[model samples]
Target: MTSRRSFIKATTLASAGLLIRPSALLPVSSRYIGLQLYTVRDAMQQNAAGTLQRVAGLGYNAVEGATYTGTQQFYGMNAKAFAALLKQQGLVMPSSHYRLGAEKMKGADVKGTMLHGWDKAVDDAATVGIQYMVCAFLSPQERGNPDHYKQLAADFNKAGETCKKAGIQFCYHNHDFEFQQQNGQYPYDILLHDTDAGLVKMEMDIYWVTRAGMDPVKLMNEHRGRFPLWHVKDMDSTPERKFTEVGSGTINFKNIFKHAQEAGLKYFFVEEDKCPGDPFASIAKSIGYIKKNLV
Candidate 1:
């Protein structure tokens, strides 16, 4: 049904795609997992490359997220520059978080200025060699109703399609809000039920999962390989919710990590909402415990 002009257009598109190398298509290694980096915000803020060297000294092989509040181009550095920095430090940025800002403030006009670039984000993530590009959090406006969920599912799928072209997957990280009840149905459930599992996946934060009074292992069992990422953190023992280093609290991480294979976990990152003392020290302790106990 296509005319010669249309066929030529399609051919050009295919040629453009073919121009990309295979390195753009796959990860160099599969076994190396990462950390989200926000977990040790303090250390990163203090010393960017130095912090990465310490993490490499630990068992961690990879890191996720990007920011350098005080250092050169920490938070707002271009993707190509940052990726080079990561490679220089002998770390892999397999994944990173991007705040999918609200719709009104997120049009194409807002890109590359107030917001990050749209197509350029994928291009940068691909340039940086990330296998996954994470839409890190949701806005309050997008968190209600089955219809809203349906729309979100559609958006995620669309985003995934874009990522597919770039040879990356898209993920949704969770807090407690998505689990809030609405219209006799939970929006999280609606997202799970409606979204294409292949296109849209999860990066569960175990601390928040437990804080929401849900069982991570049970959710893994119920989902059956849908979850491929996790944020490993522990809750404090007090009556009030607080972030604690790994193995310092009551979470049964051994049992959880045991379920890794069944959950099809591609990677995991350590994330702590807040640290009482030095966050880097806390991460070091957590990584030590994870190396000794969980891994």
Candidate 2:
């Protein structure tokens, strides 16, 4: 059915590596799968390079870093070196986790944290091909005070400005604790309402939101486009309500994924803080189900 002119155009596009396949034309969230390296933390600690190879072999197109150490190295490699390794495996690092320096060691000079050397961290993130730099967690000492949350919102806005200047979006990653009431208002709400939506976006951890008894779809509908990053994991059906592989759990991911466009999702990383048996096998199951059904 191809005309000669159309055929030539197609040939030229393909030759120039610009040919858009059906899958390529599909929504990015539907086609791409990324892993949060924390899922295989042990393996990564043991052998970062080999673990990345095995992960790429499992068909992940991207990855998110968990441990940006006090030394400002990802895993054990500097930003440029780590980025090179990811490129070698045909993988991209779209996002990486950073901290607010709430847990810094005693008398230690830590660089590349939210509270210290943040600009340097943002610069390093840019070098590593990261589009998003996330405030990964809040230590217990940092929570329980409404004043602290308000201060955090202010701090996040400042950090967001720094990231914006560097061409990166700053995001906050949540756990269930954010949903808990603080002075009759949720800290998460404070963070969401106080920050500039353009600068400080949210990285919604679907599992945590669900665990907090909130609907991910509803939240996305409420704050459309504010959430661009997601942590994709599942909850077991058991009473314990623990982490399980993607399709093996009770989350309606097929339905959630249908709303990806509304969520403004650019990238999602599969993360399981705790996995029984081999973590690689667990990720394999998660990505397999995602490719087959969810995405």
Candidate 3:
């Protein structure tokens, strides 16, 4: 009553020079834009915990993993050891990629994929504290006909339903193979149309999608809300189509970010299976570009 507007102005000024409360600050870029550890798997192997620390030092607050190389477990350490290290570095793992070739589901002596030591794959996902379980790559054996993808879609539905019980989702990550036509339709079209919308969501690797000769943004629109995650890598300018760090590549990240919501995108992970020089330096550059330009 004495002067409400003046009092509010004075309060704002009092706090202007002071650090705003943590909750009051806006988030930096998309905090969910994480790195898939496979980008720097070799470094992690050299020193498990320290590698994660380096990734964190570069400003990544989250990670999506390639999971296990040799005996180096996902995140480059055992569950307990890795979890401790992640906490120290303020990192969270919202998702991970796992090989899902038919061999993984149908093994000889091992029963199933070595990574998933069970009769079922869904159970293995819950044990890891991840909400998203992705089918990373498919062997050529898994492709060929519409029936193959149909069956794969059906299996995905069943597995997705299995994960639902534990509050999880089953997703498929695509390479160029899915873009090939089967019968009259693209294999990806069949998979999308055949799979239960709720069961088989997509993890669109933008670079691969682009490499497959499709528009990433259009795919996001056509299958609205189907893509919950993305593998954020860039393609070199050369005709050979080599991989490069973000921004340095030809992908239009700024235009793509406009459709983030419709894509149902919850996380974006940097994954470069091969690199020229120090992978960490490349990732650092990618992070800097994301924060400075793409953010």
Candidate 4:
């Protein structure tokens, strides 16, 4: 594990010449912390309402949703009912991950037919009062050819347009694969350069970017306001670099957060893909750490 002194020194060095002031990086308010519902998938799968009650009890005022499409419901409840449940728990969802189906993209024009059920998806999201709809993943077939990403970019722009019409923003969430080279060019770069910045935004998964040996702070500096949402998880200090509760691992979140303004970060959600014990317990620990240290 990195010592506190060493971590502070590293952060100071990293921020040099970046125009990021340490004083401005302090946690401004409690609303910054949020729970990604995927962290407690098992609990949610069994009892969505009860699980959300527990999430709110853990001091989470905001949440990001993961399940919406397959069940055509938000955790077995209709959109209105689900929204009511969230209200009862005193929580609000700002973003939800909606998969971009590969089947829908085939023989579909970017403007009209690329996304199936997207209009309904947007309607439900609006009913639930979400501000952003995220395209969560890309399947192997969709990413098999290098040229496919260009089409995907066009699809994203069209999707963003659709989302904009409905008073929502569209975003893409990335895994490590996006940073890898394909035909001597990074797919992530293609997406960034090809897509319209105003139309499409990005949700940065810090864990995946770190796993790919990339620096989140540098990426933020490079992009300068493209990322508005973040997945805030930590990596254990083992050879495997497994998922762990936030602030109990090797990732220097304090350092990354110092550049939050440049990253355009408005909200962040804690996500632990795997945990040693109860997911709720892990989230509690993460929240405690964030409150005391990272925020």
- Which candidate number maximizes lDDT? 2
lDDT of 1 by residue, 17-92 (tens): 3233435422112345467788777677677778888887776778887442112233555655666677777777
Pairs in steric clash, model 4:
none
Candidate 4 residues 248-289, lDDT tens each?
999999999888888988778999999999998999999999
Global lDDT of each candidate: 0.70, 0.84, 0.72, 0.81
User: Clash number for model 3?
Assistant: 0
Local error of candidate 2 at residue 113 (angstroms): 0.9
RMSD of each candidate relative to the true structure: 6.9, 8.0, 10.6, 11.2
Better candidate number, 1 or 2, judged by TM-score:
2
lDDT of 4: 0.81
Ranking by lDDT: 2, 4, 3, 1
Could you give candidate 2's per-residue lDDT for residues 75-159 as a string of tens digits? 8888778877887887777789998875668867567788888867876776676778999999896775777888999889999
Better of 1 and 4 by lDDT: 4
Clashes of each: 3, 0, 0, 0
Ranking by TM-score: 2, 4, 3, 1
Report the error of model 2 at residue 222, Å.
Answer: 0.6
